[model samples]
Target: MNLLVRRLFWISFAVCGTVSLVWGHDVGEGDLKVTVLAKSSDAWDDKPLPHYPTGQPEITVLKIIIPEGKKTPLHFHSVINAAVLLKGEVDVHMPAGETKKLKAGESLIEVVDKAHWGENVGQGDAEFLVFYAGEKGEKITHVLHGDETPEAVLQEANR
Candidate 1:
């Protein structure tokens, strides 16, 4: 009986492992549609997208949290990004001197070669889930440090 139980346990483990491998989480098709604007752009002159990618694809899941009165500074992702705001309000500043407000449950598809800055515009912290698609080895963001630029800030963070 002890040997039989051990064998059954091993079988169950193997089955579970196989199932997990075979059934990877499916990225929703609707999610892909959100970033169509960025993905469809022909000019990818941003820091991360020096050249259009043409091979293996990569997906990055980004969870950004901005504390009250804190800002995300100015930056952009290397690949096209589709994002959904989870909490609070965030103001996105375009390089062209335009600002747009995004609230919880709202989504955005940023265009390629665009520079931007983000700030928490609400009284509380704001959170967001961002999905990006690009090549494996690309720089995701460029920091504009000049005060004159619309999205100027110190030290750029790239992922």
Candidate 2:
């Protein structure tokens, strides 16, 4: 009985020592960590996020790359959308003269139903991952005509 007890104690000690050695070993030179870049209770405009449209939800993800000195046409999202800047920099401009700049590794909760455009202002190409949340069969983006403004589009949508 004493022999058996001694053997069991040594076995337990060996197992625990092995575990501790493995756990304490440095896997890499630097400490791995996660950081939250952006968090918001409301959209960028400080307004509550728009409600999801009825019917089956259709979610879309897009990786867009804009070359330096390029700009998108004035457009609005009919659905809730957001984007994360993957590389370079971009400036989001609204018709009301508001502007927001985003750099690499940053995120933005895009303004919904508002006419705006994005421009790549950096020397390198700008890349972003954008997500759209909408209902099936709904149009996600609407490009504005030459004479149309955001307010006009909003009014027309309400009518």
Candidate 3:
């Protein structure tokens, strides 16, 4: 009877230990969550980022606000730039007719040296944080007149 009782105790202990090891660990929720918006080796158009000018790097960050129904002039970034929409919605249009709509909490890796424009399409004001990776004294953006072609712009930039 003593041997049987001892055997039963050991078996129960082993079963309880195994069950605790398998199911007793805590799986608690975290306070904050992070989502990656964009991760790319190239720009939106699949082109490599342009080389930074030979000088100390200059970084520029701007909080741009676009009133409802407003549109940006056709322009292009000479340096690598990106933006994260903070408040509302915007339609980004390229000269080649491609368009992308970005909303709050979304981010974009903008095209470099490509002509494009942005229009606020939301009911309220649109806001975004634009960041430029450039060199000091270099022009970060070039706004085009209505009739200018990208070829002409590139030529002027080279001269």
Candidate 4:
């Protein structure tokens, strides 16, 4: 019967619509998208990442907030680390005076056993997430005071 055929057609249409809606569309379809922000074995400074330490592996994630116009303490990380800038702009400087600038949504693989620091240069707080790979009982970050020199910091970090 005509009515029976019409019902089947409508049901098929509805099912197809539901399937498309649930599965969504791919990149070319413009319904969803993905991006590779960063991928590398070297830090932003072009230095190769250090070898993993021996012992119980530990992974640490830190959410750091730097107030506008403020600077973080000069410090060094003993292990390999990376970061994604979530908000505002910041400039990271190495003890040797080299600098790397970053803005919101940007990422950087950080230097290991090197003294460096960051300054929030934007109009708002600079926020970032840092991921560290290290071993248990090992200190990841070593902060240096105004009186401490970069050489001292590096020596401490290497030790």
Tens digit of lDDT per residue, candidate 2, span 1-159?
Answer: 454345334433432334444445566534543344555546677777766655666667789999999999999888877788999999999877888998998889888888889999998999998877666887788899998876687688778
| Best first by lDDT, ranked | 4, 3, 2, 1
Task: Please give the RMSD to the true structure for each candidate, in Å.
Answer: 13.4, 15.8, 18.9, 15.3
TM-score of each: 0.59, 0.72, 0.74, 0.74
**lDDT (Cα, 0-100) at 25 in candidate 3:** 50
Q: In order, what lDDT does every prediction score? A: 0.59, 0.75, 0.76, 0.78
Q: Candidate 4 residues 18-89, lDDT tens each?
A: 444434665477554445456677988998976765566666789999999999988988887778899999
| TM-score of candidate 4 relative to the true fold | 0.74
* Candidate 1 weakest lDDT stretch, 10 residues: 29-38
Q: In model 2, where do residues sit more than 4 Å from their true spots?
A: 1-34, 150-159
Please give the distance, in angstroms, between residue 72's alpha carbon in candidate 2 and its true position after superposition. 0.5
lDDT score at residue 91, model 4, on the 0-100 scale? 98
Tell me the tens digit of each residue's lDDT in model 1 across 68-140.
8888766655566567788999888876777778888776665555667788988788998776666676655
User: Which clashing pairs does model 2 show?
Assistant: none
Off by over 4 Å in 1: 1-52, 147-159
* lDDT comparing candidate 4 with the true structure: 0.78
lDDT of 3: 0.76
